[model samples]
Target: MADPIPETADTALVPTLLGDVIPRVESAYVLGLPSPQILDLVLERSRSTTVLVATDEEASQLKDELPDAVELVTAGIAAFAQDRRSQPRELVLALGGLDGLLPPADTMPWQQRLAHVTALAQAGGTVIVGLGNDAPLMALGHAERIDWARADDDPTRPTSAAALAQALAAAGQPVTTVHGLYGDPVNPGAAVIDALATGSRDGSLPAQVVEHVIDQAGTASIPAPDVVAVAARSGQLSNLATQWVAVSGGRGRSVYWTVDDAVVWADQDGPGLDWVIGGDADTAAALPQRVPDTITVERTLLRHIARADLPAFRAVARQLGDWVRSSADAAESSEIRLDEVRVAGATLARGISLRHAPVTDAAPVAEDAPDVEREPDPSARQVSASEARLAQAWRRFATRFAHSGRRSAWPAIFGEEDLVQLWLTMSGVAPGTVAPEADAPAVAVPAVVDEASRLDILQDRVAALTDTLAARDEQLLIREARIRTLRQQALGAARNRDRAVKLAQDLRRSRTYRLANQMRRASLVAQPKTLVRGVARKLDGKVRALRRTR
Candidate 1:
């Protein structure tokens, strides 16, 4: 089809850097589905104790149709983290076929399933692998033994993902335009699949750019591909998120992740429900609600001037200059005019003066970086001269061009354990041992038998089997029964383990609370009222003396 856009990680990691700006994605939904275990874990671990599971028709349909249970569980987690803004907990995805009835995978290949799961975990859900897997089948593109797996597309689902878009638009928040398949080659299928959409030849993302991005993501196996690289709207980059995830990998080049809207614009630290509505250092007196606490705008004043009238620009620039506390620049301040344009989310106005300086691109973390477990001086990485200049130009054209920063931060997401675990799950021996072009083995021909010879052979076999048939059938029944009993025992043990884990969590919480109470009681004492009374009398005497001296 359309040369199935390139599905490489590089293609996915191409962050839209317009004037040193990036995009963010926002999602809101009920999370943790179809499992009391997951709900319990989330409740036990998260800041919010109230856990919700959407027992709707859609979840059921998704479970039945989805090939991977891990995907479904991950989907639940992503929905909670993004839309629900719920604290994350581990959701174990029971291995495919190991469970009673594996979900039917009607379409989409195994590769897509694996990547989507990676995306979910990256978005902030804890995914874990469940037991009972076909290890050999995993080698042949079958997935089992998945851990910390979640799908990205479910959060950015096709029909249900318009809330963030509309909210942002209404609040005048920047938006990153994205499309399906062609949008992110490396992450072909994403959660925020708003629709089965298409891009135009004259769109912002040209066909060439799409090809470049896709190639960066990874190559798709298509025969006789005719690829055209030109400035045609290949598609918008929606559903920003981490493209590459692994439970295990030999130290190698960084992998890419598709961008998600909620994550794309997450604040430098991350999104949190508690954001100060006004009086924040973002330089905006009052930002619209669509802007989450975790996100930061490069220059709201520059963006406003670029999008509005010149007269309006004067007022906005005046306030911005005041906020920057630049007492040195405004004395010789002058208005700006646009010469050229760069567009991603906002239409920026450009001019050469003290008003705008080149924005800085955040320096890259050392390749094979591990995690952001600690806080640091929100440092922007060392950058190049050309990149700084480009960022300035993008800022000038703030209206048409918007930058989504989501793609810039994939590596920090979907930690090492999840990635290695998933890779282990989806990898092994290739599909079948029988080669595609292999021929059947030859067999020796049986000696020909006449009708009488056949009759004699059948009669002899029947006479011999008459006595043994019952015994043979009984033996077969016994074997079947024994195997069933063994299987039942194994399953029972697993269930028991699960129950034990649940009990352990409950006990842990209770003991923790109890210990905290004991410590507080022992470490603290009530103030003595008699001592307080003496201190008050002494204070009164001292005050009376001071008054008399005055």
Candidate 2:
């Protein structure tokens, strides 16, 4: 098979930059190419295989550009979201056609479309969104912005890179500008080689100038990722939600979840330690004795363990325990810490007591994090009707609860007993009910149902039932006998009818009957009654004479 990733023009710079920062951020937006040229760049430079998601029109534009070896899925936002069966290593969302200027009738809102695309990013997959300058990128997420300034592509016009940087800075946003170099048309190989060697060749000078312009703009500031300010710890596990926020704390790092649910690897500059539960071969033996062999990570917008399995929860806690210990070991050296894990309403755990500072009052959570729960912002676009109904339901429920004069702000102020009771309720168990221990010896309790010992009575009832059935069977036999008698009578009638029909046919063919019919016809031939009578008498005499001769 042909190589999946074609080493084309020196498009490596953009892909290389994406490869470096995409793993670090929640999502990354490349604000340069109007097409999916950046996708090819990323694929050619990065070792990880990637796939492209595009609309029908976009896919049409991309026909024959990339080799058939690469997988491209053509689907709209909603269809793609519903049909995402597996996560690719990397995802490139071609959003050039989703220009902001287009009416909603023609195209979906770029913001919502972008949200869905970024939300599909796998735990380890890097999602690179390619869009034009008309669609703004800052409102999306903690997406690292890069300006690809193409040289000679449009030297006379203000390049998209320069214009985008100015727009972002005007909106008080930060952007990283990179010079995009293209190879010479005649000597493409030499030009690509030279540009790769020194960021730019002769044809790429315009891009270099655009980068300089962005630097001179003096408005854009490259700052660290901002940590969102969330409120204090909430009530019970049932009420409290796990939050995924874009913060300045963890850079060049992402918490990659393994496919086997074995570990959630936090890759960064730190001591190498695997936070593993059941799936890790080395630490499998060291796990808690009663840990489950497999774990189920909840499929929701929020990152949490949302299963009723206690053993799986313990296994998850063991992994989190490793993360906590690792965080504690490097607390002084590093800024990142694995704080309290917010369990789903279903996980069976109280709270983790950490030596370091307690988990931060989670900030107003960002809605862009994939594989985590995100509450929609009020200012954002309206969701589908079903989602709107759900939101309204929650609003109504919360409003009623608050108005009911109860002092409980469930999640924000849950007592230990309250949390336990809520967990029990969610688990379909009544409050104060003790769960039976499997290994414990069984004890005889007073029976609510009265015990009846009457084997003789049961025998008598069975005998009566048998007699009734036998009587029914006798009735059935009588019915069958009646049916047989009716059938015999019908057969006899059919035989008599057949014989009568045969006798009638034989009589009609007889010579005497034929002669009688001829005599009747000869009588009818006469005009008057007297003449007819005379002819009849003559015919009768002639018939008698003919009979005697025969």
Measured against the true structure, the TM-scores of the candidates, in listed sequence, are 0.20, 0.22
lDDT of each: 0.30, 0.34
Candidate 2 lDDT by residue in tens digits, 18-51: 3344433322322122334456554555444334
Candidate 1 Cα outliers beyond 4 Å, as residue runs? 1-3, 6-237, 240-312, 323-550
What lDDT is reached at residue 278 by model 2?
Answer: 30
CA RMSD per model (angstroms) = 38.6, 27.7
Clashes of each: 97, 10
What tens-digit string does per-residue lDDT give for candidate 1 at 1-550? 1211122222212221110111121211112332333232333333323322334454665456433312333333323335433322322121110112113333443333333333333233323211111111111221232221222323321121233334223332222322222323233322112221122222111222233344444432221012321212243222122121111111111111132221121111222332122121232221222222211122332344345333544443333323223322212222221221112132222211111232233433467656657454354344333323322222343322222221211122233233222222222211221111112222222356567757765775676577579889999999999999999999999999999999988886897878987786655445466657767899999999999998
Mark the 10 consecutive residues where model 1 has the least summed lDDT. 246-255
**Residue 425 in model 2: shift from native, Å?**
89
Worst 10 residues of 2 by lDDT: 223-232
